[model samples]
Target: MIFVNAFLVGGAICVLGQILIDVFKLTPAHVVASFVVLGAVLDSFGIYDQLIQLAGAGATIPITSFGHALLHGAMSEGHEHGYLGIAIGIFKLTSAGITSAILFGFLTALIFKPKG
Candidate 1:
């Protein structure tokens, strides 16, 4: 049930992005940035977390999720880190995901040589 809901929600978001790109001619970067901002605004209002609870990675894998992670990190760190919270906070929250991607990228690159 959870997986089904996540898949539907995540797929819908991705489909929306694809449509915007194809029909409206929005660039991927613009769509991504817009989604992040939208997510941040929604998160600040306490709506995004509830949505995430319902959708799981549906809400956590998109660029919007990145914004949410940053906001969550900042809020958590603000309790202890003061003004420096913003910068350090995002890093702390996203480090694991970032590290995993970097590691996987390095492994893939080592395994597959590219032609220039």
Candidate 2:
């Protein structure tokens, strides 16, 4: 059942991205940025938590999940460290993913040249 939920939720998000790209001619980068912002906004309203509970990684593996991490980290840290946590906690929580993304992107670029 968890697998089913994950598959359905993840597939739905991917399909939405595809529609934006194909139907609306949106760039992939724009879609990615929008989803992350949407996730952060939904989390701010306390709505995204329910979806995360229901969908788990299906919710967490998308770009939007980066926003989820940022807000979740900020709120958690804010409790202990006041406003400073809001600025620092997101990096503390998300740096690993951000670092890995940069590292792998550099490696991929080094290996694969873009086509003209």
Candidate 3:
């Protein structure tokens, strides 16, 4: 069930992106940025949490997720660290995703050894 939900929601999101591209003539970068801002705004309104619960990584693995992670991290850190939290909060929030991407890429290269 979880896998089904994730795949369906993720595919829907991709379909939406394709629609935006075809109908609105948006670029890939613009679509990504729009999602990030939209996610941030939705998070601010406390709406994205439910969608995240419903979709899991479908909602949590995109650039929008990055914004959501940063905002959530900043708020939590700001409570404990005060003003400095704003500056470092995003890195703290997104560290897991960033580190995982780097590690996975390194491991993949070591195993595959692809060359141009």
Candidate 4:
């Protein structure tokens, strides 16, 4: 049942992205940014946490989850450390993901040649 829920929810999110690209003619970058903002907004209202509870990996595996983690970390640390915590918390939850992206991108660039 959990697997079914995860599959359905994840597929629905992907379908929505496709609709944005095909019907609304948004570029992939625009769609990605929009989803991130949507996730942050939902988290601000505490709706995203509920969605995660219900959808599990379905909700956590998308780009939107990055936004959710950003806000969640910031809020959690902000309560303890005040203004500085906000800056610190922003990267705390996302540092691993960001680091891996940079590492892989660098490695790929080293291996591949770009068109002139």
Index of the highest-lDDT prediction: 4
Candidate 4: regions farther than 4 A off: 112-116
User: Candidates ranked by lDDT, best first?
Assistant: 4, 2, 1, 3
User: Of the candidates shown, which would achieve the greatest TM-score relative to the real structure?
Assistant: 4
Tens digit per residue, CA lDDT, model 3, 2-114? 77888887888788888989999999999989888887888888877887899898888667777787788887888888989777685787898889999999999889965
Tens-digit per-residue lDDT, 1-116, candidate 1: 77987899899989989998999999999899988888888889998899789999888887788777778888888778887877678667778888999999999999998978
The candidate, 2 or 4, that scores higher on lDDT is 4
What are the per-residue Cα lDDT tens digits for candidate 4 across 19-109?
9999999999999999999989999999989988998999998889889999999998999999889998987888899999999999999
Q: Encode model 2's per-residue lDDT on 1-116: one tens digit a residue.
A: 77788788888989999999999999999999999988899899887888778888888887888898888899888889999989868776688999999999999999999998
What TM-score quantifies how close candidate 2 is to the native fold?
A: 0.85
Better of 2 and 4 by TM-score: 4
Off by over 4 Å in 2: 110-116
Q: List the RMSD of every prediction in angstroms.
A: 2.0, 2.0, 2.7, 1.9
- Residues forming the 10-long window of minimal summed lDDT in candidate 1: 85-94
Q: Please, what is the TM-score per model?
A: 0.85, 0.85, 0.78, 0.91
lDDT of each: 0.86, 0.88, 0.83, 0.92
lDDT of 1 at 60: 88
**What is the RMSD of candidate 4?**
1.9
